[model samples]
Target chain A: MTDVASPHTDPEQKRGLFETLEIDTRLLGMIGAFILICLAFTWYTDGRFLSARNIFNLTIQTVSVAIMATGMVFVIVMRHIDLSVGALLALCSAVMGLLQVRILPQYGIPLGSPLIAPIAMAAGILTGAAVGALNGWLVGYQGVPAFIVTLGGLLIWRNVGWYLTSGQTLGPLDPTFLKFGGSEGTLGVTLSWIIGALAAAAAVWAVWRARQVKERHEFPVKPIGAEVALSVVIAASILGFVYFLNSYLIPDARLKRMFEARGEVMPEGYTEGFGLPISVVVVIVVAIVMTIIALRTRFGRYIFAAGGNPDAAELSGINTRWLTVKVFALMGILCGLSAVIAQARLQNHTNDLGTLDELRVIAAAVIGGTALSGGVGTIYGAILGALIMQSLQSGMAMVGAEAPFQNIVVGVVLALAVWLDIQYRKRTGALK
Target chain B: MTIETKIDPRGTPLVEMRDISISFGGIRAVDHVSIDLFPGEVVGLLGHNGAGKSTLIKCLSGAYHADAGDIFINGEQAVINNPRDARGYNIETIYQTLALADNLDAASNLFLGRELVTPMGFVDDGAMEAETRKIMARLNPNFRKFKVPVAALSGGQRQSVAIARAVYFNARILIMDEPTAALGPHETQMVAELIQELKREGLGIFLIEHDIHAVMKLCDRAVVMKNGARVGTVNVAEVTDDDILGMIILGKKPPQAV
Candidate 1:
C-alpha cells in the first residue's frame, strides 16, 4: 500500500516567506508591480511623478472608478458583467446636478442651503438604484443576458443624461456637494494623522482577534514573530502614507487668499498640507465595506457558490434569482455613489462625464484578479487594479504620450495581466 | 441470497409520497408513483436509465415539484415547494453528481444555505471549519484537505463531503442517489458501513442504485421502477437477485413479491 501525502502535511518541508507570512502571493505581486510602475514614472518625469502632490491627485483620481470596481468584483464573481456603470454614473450625476442647480432652487431652496446637497445625493442614489433594479429584473426574471441588458442601459442612460441636461453642462453645484470632489475638501494634517493612528490600531487589533479566534478553535496559529512583523508593516505603511500626503504643503498664495476671504491677515510662514481628500476617504470607506461584505456576508458566499456551480447552489435551496437582482442593485448603488464623486470633482454634470469609464472599471476589476469566468475575486484587488489603471493613464499623460498611445498601453497591459494571471493559476493548479 | 431482518410494519411511516407525478415539457417523467419508508429502514430504488427512479426521488428531495401528489412526513402532510422546504422537514439529499460548489471549501459547501452566523450576522467561518473538522474526523478520518476548494479533492473525497453534509444536518430522512458511484471499493465499503450506522441511529434512507448485488446486501426492501412507474417492491429476503433483476429489466413483479 502506498501513502499519498497531502500538501499541508509535509511537516519537514521548509516554507517560503510568503507562505509563512500567509500573504496572498498575487497581492504581493500587485504591490510590487505598482511600486515598479511608480518608480518608472518617477524616472521618466524627472521625479515630479512621485511628488506628494501627484500622489494625492492620483488617489483622488482613482476614487470614482475604484468605487464602481469594488461592486464589479461581486458582479463578475457571480458570472455577470455590468456594462452600464459609466452610463449610470452619468445619469446619476445629471440627476444630482439638476436637483442641486435647477430643481432645488426653483422650489425656493437656496443653492447654499444645507438641505440641497443631501437632497440631491438622495435623489441621485435612488435613481441609480431604481435603474439598477430594472436592469437586474430584466436579467434575472426576464431571462435577458446581462451583457445585452447592460449594453442597452449604456446607450439609453447616456442619452437620458444628455437629454436631462439639454446637451449643456450643469454645474456650479452646491459647495457642500462639491466637497466630495478631491481637492475642494480634505482632511487636514492633524485629522489625517489621527485617522492613520486609528487605522493602524484597528489593523493590529484585527490580527490579534483573528489569532484569538483560531486559538479558541484549537487551530494552528501563525508564528508570533510573523504576526508582529505583519502588524509593524501594516502600521508603518499607513502612517507613511499620512506622512507623505502631509508633505505636500498648501501654497502660500492659496493660504493668503483663504485668509483674505475670512477677513483676516495672513500670518508669516503659515502653511498646512492637504492630508487626505474626501473623495479618497470615500474610496477607502467603500473598499473596506465592500471587502467585509464579500468576506463576511451570506450574500457574498452565495455569489461565489452560485458562480462556482449554479446547479449546486440551486439544489442547496439558494434563491439565486433574487441574489442576482440584489447584486445588480448593489452595483447600481455604487454607481450612484461614484457619480457623486465624479460630478463633485468636475464641479458639473456633462453628457460625457463617465464616457469609457465602464471599460476602465471592468479592466480594473479583472486586473485586480476577479476571474471573468466567475467564482473568484477580491475587493482589495479591485481597488488596487483601479489604482494601477489610473496610474498607467496618468503616468503616460505626464510623460507627454498621446491619448491614443495611452489607451494602447492600457489595453495591452490589461491583456498581459490577465494572461499572466492565467499562467499563475495554471502553475498552481488553481485554474478551474 | 441476503438475510433480511423482519420489521414490524405497525407504526407511522417516516415519509410517504402518495400518487406522485411530475412532467417535463409535457412528458410524464414520473407517473403515479407512490412509496413509503419507515424509521431505521433502507429502501432501495432500482431501475434502468430513464426509468424515473431519479426523477421520483428528486420530488422528495425538493429538486422538482410533483405535478400531482401529497407527501406526508410522520403521517403529517408536508409541503415541499423547494429544496429549502424539504430541508426544513429534516430531509437531505446526496445527489448523484455530488452537487458541490467547486470553488468553495468543504466547510462552505457543507453549509451552503444554512451557514452558522455570529451575533453580528456575519458568517462564522472559523466555527464552521471547526464543526467541519469534527464531522470529517468522524466520517472519514483520512480526509484532511479542509482548506482547499472541493474541486481539488479526489472523487472519493468529494463523495465524503457530500455524505458529511447530509449526515451533519441531523437529517431524519436521507435520499442518496448513487452515493457510491464515484467511490473506490474501500470507500464503497465505508459508505455501506455508514448506511448501517445511520440505520441503527434511526435514519430512514432512500438508496438509489443500479448495482443489484449492493441492493441485495444493503437494502431491507427493494422498490423497482421502470418507465416512470413502480413495478413492485419486495423484501430483500424473499426476492433473490434474479427476481429483482427481472423487476428492473422486464418491469414485472416477481411471483414471490405477489
Candidate 2:
C-alpha cells in the first residue's frame, strides 16, 4: 500500500502492469470459481453439461434467485437479514394466481386477455411491497430486531399463501403470460448477437473511460496492452455466450416428427435458434440496473455507510431508520419480480412455492462477496454468486447426484467460500 | 505566520452553553457546565477519563441532548436535537474515531451523507473526486490515497480526511475530539498550521485534548473539568503549566476563575 502521508520516491513505486490495474481479488476469485465449476461439470457429464442447450437452461434456472440475490446484496451490505424473501415470493405469487384464477375472472376479464398478466403482476408486486412495508415498520419504528421480524414473516407469509389458495396449486396461466420465463419467447439470434456487440462496446468504453480518469488524475495506469487484453477477454466471453446460445437447435427432430405426424407441414427454409431465454434477459436487465444503483447513487452509498457504522452514519446526519425501511421495501419489490418469473417458469403456483429459497439467495450473496458483517458487497458479485450456486446444483443433478448429497455439498461449498473470503480479507487487513 | 503581539479584542461570543446538564441512566455525566466561545478562538477542554468533557461537548454537537439547560448562538437560543441540527448551525464534529466508513474510499467518506449529485440524482463521483483532490491538495499536500479506502491509509492521512471533511463543510464552530491523537509530529504541525488558518478565517473551535503542550500552543483559553464539574477556565497566556496542573489535579481554581 502506498503511504498517503509520504511522497513516493521509492523505485518500487512503479508497479507491474497487472498490479497497477488493481482488479478486485474477490471478483477474480468468483470468475475463477465459476470457470472451474463449469469445467468440472463438463468433464463429469462427458461434455453434456456444457452443451448449448444446458448452458441456456442453466442461465434461465439462475434467473429468479439471481434477481432476488441482487436485492439481498443490498440488504446484507446494510447489515440486515431478510429471511422472509422466500415466503414473500410465495405470497406474491399466490396473490397473482388468485387474481388471475378467481378474482379477475368474475370481473368479466377474459382469461386469455394479455391485460390480465400485467395487472396480476402489478398486484403481486404491490402485495409484496405492502408486506415489506409492514416488515420495515416493525423493524424500524417498532424497534423489533430484523431477524425476529423476518423470521415471523417467513412463517406468516407462507401461511398466507396457503390460506389464499386453500392449500391447492393454481395455474395454467395465459400462454402470453407464461412467455416471460419460457424458452420460446427469447431475444432471438440476431438480437442476442446485437446485444452481445453492444455489451462489448460498453465494456471497451468503460475501460477507456477509466484509463482517461487515471491519466487525468496523474495516477499510474495499466499498460495499454494489458488493458486491451482485459477488455478482449470480457468481450470474447459475452460474444461467445451469444454464439453458443444461437447454436442450440430448437424444435429438435423429435418435436418435428410429432408435428409432421400431426399432418402439419414444416415451413420452407424455416430455422430456429435457442437465442437468449426471456428470464435470463430479465435477470440481466435487473443486474445492470441494480449495479448502477449500487455504484452511482446516493442511496447506495448511504447503505454502505449505515452498514459500516450505524452510530457514525447517524452522527453524520443520515436517517438510518428510514434507510432501513427503504432497503426492505426494495427487497420486497424484488421478491415480487422473482415471484412472477418463478411462477411462469413452473407453470403453476404451489403452496410450497419458494420454500428454502432464502438460504440459496443468501448463499449466493455471500459467495459473491457480500460480507455478512455488512458494509461490503456489490450487485454484480451477488448475481454471479447466484450463477455459481445454480451451476453447482445443475451440474450435480446432471451427474445423477441425490438431493441430500447435493444439499450437503452446496452447504460445504458455501462455508468454504466464506472462509476463503475471510482469509482474503485477513491478508489484505480489510477484515474490519 | 506572525505571532500576535497582543491578543486582538475579543469578538462577540459565537456560542454559549448555559448551565447544560445531562445524565445517563443514574449517572450525571455532565452537570450544569457553562462555557462560551468567541469567533476565531480555540478553547481547550482538559479532563481525565470520565471527567464529563466529552459528554458536555456531545450536547452542543447534538450527539446527546441536554436534559437541562440551553444553548445560544450569537445570543439567540438555538434548538439542537440531533447531529443534523448541529450541522444546520454550521457546527461540525471530527470524532476521536474519525467516524469514516472503512469500506469506502477517501472521496466517498468525505461526502458520505451529503453527497454531490448530478441533476439526474446520480452521485457525481467525478465532480466529488475533483473537489476532494482540490481540498486534499490544499490541506495535506502529501495525501495521495484518494482512490483507496480510509482504512488503508496511514493514521495521519485518516486524520487529514476527517479534518478536511469538517473544514470543507463551512464549519463556523468546530468540535474536534483528539484530532491529533493518532498523528506524528509532522502531521501535528500540519494540523497546528491548519488551525491557525481556520482561526484567521474567524471560525470558533473546541478542542478536547490531553497533551498540555498542544493546549499551550493552540488554545487561547483552557477549561479544566473534574468529577463532572468545571474546575476553572483560565486565559492560557496568564497561567503556567503548573497552575493549570493544580486546577486539574488538585481541583483548585486560579485567582481569575471566578
Candidate 3:
C-alpha cells in the first residue's frame, strides 16, 4: 500500500542502491558461507579440496539431495514437513531393483535390455508417488498432522525397502541406466559451453523483460546499472562453471604417477576431459523447473498464502487442505527422481540406500533460507544449501577427518546457518 | 466507463437475513435477528462487544452458518455453506483483523484465491499489479508500496489493501467489520470517503462499528442490537446519537420496533 517516502520521491528512487540488488542478506550470507567454506577447505587440504576433480565429485554428491530439497522447499513453506523422503527413496529404488532382478526376469525380460531400465525407473518413481499420495490423503483429508504421518511413513517405508531387497544389496544395474549417473554420460566441453551460453542469454532476457514491464506500469524499476551488473555476474558465473568442469580430466591425471610406479603404461586413446556431470545437469533442470513453479504459478502463491495464515487463506476462498495434499504429492514425485539418481550413481540398491537422507534434505532447505516456521523459501536457495552441505562433507573427508567429527561439524554448521537466518529476519523485521 | 453500469437498475434489496439465530456452546450468540440492505444504502450495525452484532454479520458473510434462518439474495433463497459460496454471490467481507496474508505483497493478497492467470496457468503478476495500481489510485491514491509485504504497511495502508481486495472482485454486497477501528483520524477520514464513493456506485454495505460518530456520519440507517437481540432499526435522521446509545446500553426498543 502506501509508503513512508515523500510524495515527490519517485517510486524508483525510494529504494537505496543495495536494496535494488533484490538479493536479500540471507542469500548473500549463504553465498558468503559457500565461498568461505571453499577457501578454508582448499587451504586445509593443500589445494586438493578445490581441485577440479573433487569439485566435480562434490557436485555429483549434492545432486540427489538438491533435487529433493527443491521439493522440500514447497512442503516446508506450506507449513508441513516430510520425514519420509529418505525412506521413500530407498523403498522406490529397491522396488526398481526387485523388478530388475526377480520380477521382470521371471516375465521373460532379459537383463540389460534398454526397455528394462525405463520400466524399472517408472515403477520406482510410481511407487514413491503412490506412497506420497497416501501421506497426503491422511494428512490433508483425514486431518492428521504431517509430522506424525510422515514420521510413521519414515519407519514403514524404510522397512519396506529392506523387505523388498530381502535385507541384501541388489544391483550392478542395467548398463544403460547406469550411464545417466556416471561420467560416460556427461555432456562434453563444447556442449557444456553451449548450454552455459544459452542459460546466460535467458537470464539477460528475463531481466530485460522484467524491466520493460516495470517501466510500462510506472512501478519502481531496478536501475539499469544494477541490472547490467547482475547480468554480467550471472554470465561470468555460468562461463566460469563450464571452464572449471572442462579443466578436470577424466581417469584423473593425478593418478598417472601411481600407474607409472606400478610399471603400467597409460592406456592409449583414453577419453580426456570430464565435461559436465550428468547428475549436475539433472539437478539444474529440476531446480529451474521447481523455481518456476514456486515463483510463477497460481498454485505456488496459494502455498505461501495458506502457509502464512490458513484462516485468512480459507476466508479468501482457498482450499487450504487440498493445497496441502497437492504440495505433498509434488514432494513425492521429487523423491522418486532422487531415487533413480541415487540407485544409478551407486549401481545398487541396498537396505541402507538413502538412509538418513531426509535430515540432509531438510538441513539444506533450512540453511538455504527456507524458514522452518513456513511461508518463506526458494528452490535455488535450497539447492545452494545442499551444495554447501555436501562441500563440507567432501572437504572434511578429503582432509582425513573422522566420520564422527565430520558429523559434528556439519551439525554445527546447520545450526549456525539457521541462527544466522533468524538474525537476518529480525534485522529486517521480516519475522512475524 | 463509470461504475454505474455494474449496479442493478431494479429497486430491490440486495440481501435479507430473516429470523437468523445461532448458538455456541449453549450460549445463544444471535437470536432471531433480521436485517435488510437495499442497493446504494450504508446500514450500520451498532452493538457492544459480544452483543452478537458480529455474529449476525458473519452469517451473512458466510463465515458462520445460522442455525435457524433463511437468507435471501435478490428475493431468492441462497445457500452459503462456506466462504466460496459467499463469493459466488459476489459478497466480500473485510474482517476486523483485516485477514491478509502478512508475508505477501499487496497485489498477491489482493488476488489470493481468485488469481488471474495466463492461459498457461501461470499467475500473470504484471497484469495483476497494473490492475491493483488502477484500483488503489481510485480508492487510496497515495498507495504506492506495491512490492513490500502488507505486514510492513501502516494500519491505514493495510486497511486500504483489504478494502481494495474486496472492491476489486465485483462484490455487490460488502461487509466491513470495524474498517477504521485501528486507524488514525486522517486514515479514518480516508476510509469514510472510500465508503461514500462505494455508496455512490450503488453497492450495499454493512458497516459494523462501535464509533457512534462514524455511524452518524456515514450510515443512512442504524440497526442496534443488545444481548443477542435486536433493539430497533432506525433511520439516522430519525434518531440522535444518544437514542442509539440508549438502545445499545439498556436493551430498550424504540416505538417502531415495539
Please report the candidate that would top lDDT against the real structure: 1
- Please give the CA lDDT of all the candidate structures: 0.90, 0.86, 0.86
lDDT of candidate 1 over A1-432, digit per residue (tens): 012224464432555666656788999999999999999999999999999989988988999999999999998988989999999999999999889888999998878999999999999999888998888888888989999999999999989998988988997889999999998888899999999899999999999999999999998788999999989999999999889888888889888998999999998978889888888888888988888888899999999999889899999999988989989999999999999999999998888998999999999999999999989899999999999999999999999999899999999989998998999887655675
Order the candidate numbers by lDDT, best to worst: 1, 2, 3
Per-residue lDDT tens digits of candidate 2, residues B1-258?
Answer: 111123335644788888888998989898878888999999999988899999999998888999998898976899999999999999999999999888888888888788999799989787788889889888877676777667777788888888889988999999989888888777788788888889999999999999999999999999999988888889999989888888888989999763
Which DockQ values do the candidates obtain, in the order shown?
0.48, 0.41, 0.42
Q: Which stretches of candidate 2 lie over 4 Å from their true place?
A: A1-14, A212-221, A252-264, B1-9
Give per-residue CA lDDT, model 3, range A82-162, as digits (tens): 999999998988898888888887888868787898999899888877888888889888999999999999999989889
Each model's backbone clash number: 0, 0, 0
lDDT score, residue A349, model 1?
Answer: 88
Q: Which residue runs of candidate 3 sit more than 4 Å off their true CA positions?
A: A1-14, A252-270, B1-11, B23-28, B226-229
Candidate 3, residues B93-148, lDDT tens digits: the string is 99999999988999999999888897898888888999998988877777778877
Clashing pairs in 1: none
Those runs of model 1 whose alpha carbons end farther than 4 Å from true positions after fitting are A1-17, B1-8
TM-score: which is higher, 1 or 2?
1
Lowest lDDT 10-residue stretch of candidate 1 chain A: A1-10
- In the order shown, the candidates' Cα RMSDs to the true structure are 3.1, 4.2, 5.0
